[model samples]
Each structure stands twice: as structure tokens, then as C-alpha cells.
Target: MTYSLLNLAFLVPAAVLALVATLRVPHRRRFLRGLGLTLLVVLVLTAIFDNVMIGIGLVAYEREHLSGVFIGIAPIEDFSYAVFAAVVLPSLWSLLRPSRRRPRAHA
Candidate 1:
């Protein structure tokens, strides 16, 4: 399969995990805010590093698998990995966190 198809296969599961995590976890607003911030940081870092790697011939993508889009030398499709990490990691963390219990009041 082409790289683009492989990316799509992974992305669909990552998106679903993020959605289920947001719905099931507590503090939805905070989780969303954190996710947004994470996405922004990941996007910036991926753009810088991926472009630099491609520029120096340390990395490359097969043109046939790409959608003919570019952000500098990095293929636009490359950003999907960073985005998947940002969403999936935090969602998994939230899902796996230990639950907190409230103290009982004395009568």
C-alpha cells in the first residue's frame, strides 16, 4: 500500500481514540485545551525538523504516495504523524490516569 493509505489507516484509529477519550474522561474542557496546545507545538516542531531533514537529504518521501502538497521540503502528509502523536498520547494518558475519590463528610 502507498504511504498515504498507511497514514490514513493509522489516523482513523487515532481520531477515534481521541474522540472516545474526550467523551469518557473528566475535565473535558481542560483536556481539549491541552490537546489544542499540544497540536500547535507539534505542528511547529514537525515543520521545522521535517523540513530540515528533507533539505539535508536525511529524509525523503516517495512522490507517488504523496498528494503533491508541500510545506517547504517536507510533504504535507508528514504532519499527520505528529498530529497523531499529540492526540493519541494525551488521550491515552487521560484514559489511564488513576481515579480520584472524594473524602466523606463527618456527621
Candidate 2:
């Protein structure tokens, strides 16, 4: 499969997990704001580092696998991994965290 298709294969599930976590987790507003900020930071860093790596020939992507969209020399597909990480890591963390509740008082 093409790179974009492969990226979507992982990204779709990660996005779904993130959405479910956003709905089920407490403090929806806070989680969303944090997710947004995390995405922004990751995207920016990925773009800068990816472009530098590509320019230096340390990183290379097959042109046929790319969508022809780019931010600098990095294919847009390159950013999806960061996006997936930003969404999936927090979702998995929230999902796996132990619930906190006090035991009921004895009669």
C-alpha cells in the first residue's frame, strides 16, 4: 500500500481512540486543550527536524509513496506519525490510568 494509505491505517485508529478518550475521560476541556497544544508543538518540531533531515539526505521517502504535498522538503505524510503519537499516547495513558475513588464509609 502507499505511504498515505499506510499512515491512514494507523492514524484512523489513533484518532478514534483519542476521540473516545476525550468523551470518556474527565475534564473534557482540559484534555482537548492539552491535545491541541501537544499537536501544535509536535507538528512544528516534526516539520523543522524532518526538513533538516531530508535536506541533509539522512532521511528519504520514496516519491511514489508520497502525496506530493510538502512542508519544506518533508512530505506531508511525514507529519502523520507525530500526529498519531500526540493523539495515541495521551489516549492510551488516560485509558490505562488507574481510577481514583475513596472506599465507601462503613455503617
Candidate 3:
């Protein structure tokens, strides 16, 4: 399979987890706002760093397996990892972590 297909396979589950978190977690507006900002920052950083890494020969992809879409030298398929960082992991953290507002346990 192509890199884009691999990215899609990973991204679909992460997107579902993020969606579930949006529904079940508290402070929906804040979560969305933070998600947007985080996505923006992470994507930009990923673009810059990925381009640099590729330029310097620190990273490489086979042309046959790539989607042929790029931001500079970085493959577009590379950005799904940034989405996972900006969205899925945070959603999982929020979903899995105990709430700060939980009532103190009775003695």
C-alpha cells in the first residue's frame, strides 16, 4: 500500500477517538479552540522541520510509495503524525485522565 493509505488507516482511528472525546469530555468550546490552535502550530512546525530533515538527508521516502504531494520536500502523508499529536493524543489523555473536579472521597 501507499504511504497515503497507511496514513489514512492510522488517522481514521485517531479521528474517531478525538470525536468521542469531544462528545464526552467537558468544556467543548475550549477543547475545540485548543485543538484548532494546536493543529495549526503542529502542522507548521511539522512542515518546517520535515522539510529541513529531508533537505539535510535525515529523512527520506521512496518515490514509488509516496503520494507525490509535498510541502517543500516533506510528503503530505507525513503530516498525519502532527494531527495525531494535536488531536488524538490529547483526546485520549482527556478521556483517560481523572477529572480535576471529581469529588473528594469520603472518609
Instruction: Report the backbone clash tally of model 2.
Output: 0
Instruction: Give the range where candidate 2 is weakest over 10 consecutive residues by summed lDDT.
Output: 94-103
Per-residue error for 54 in candidate 1, Å, reads 0.3
lDDT of each: 0.92, 0.92, 0.89
TM-score, each model? 0.91, 0.95, 0.90
> What lDDT score goes with residue 68 in model 2?
96
lDDT of 2 by residue, 1-106 (tens): 6799999899999989998999988899999999999999999999999999999999898898889999999999999999999999999998889988788999
Which runs of model 1 end up more than 4 angstroms from their true locations?
103-107
lDDT minimum window of 10 residues, candidate 1: 1-10
Candidate 1 to truth, TM: 0.91
Candidate 3 yields a Cα-based lDDT of: 0.89
Q: Please, what are the lDDT tens digits per residue for candidate 3 over residues 7-79? A: 8888899899989999997799998888899899999999999999999999889899998988998999889
The best-first sequence of candidates by TM-score reads: 2, 1, 3
Error of 3 at 95 (Å): 0.5
* Number of the predicted model whose lDDT against the real structure is largest: 2
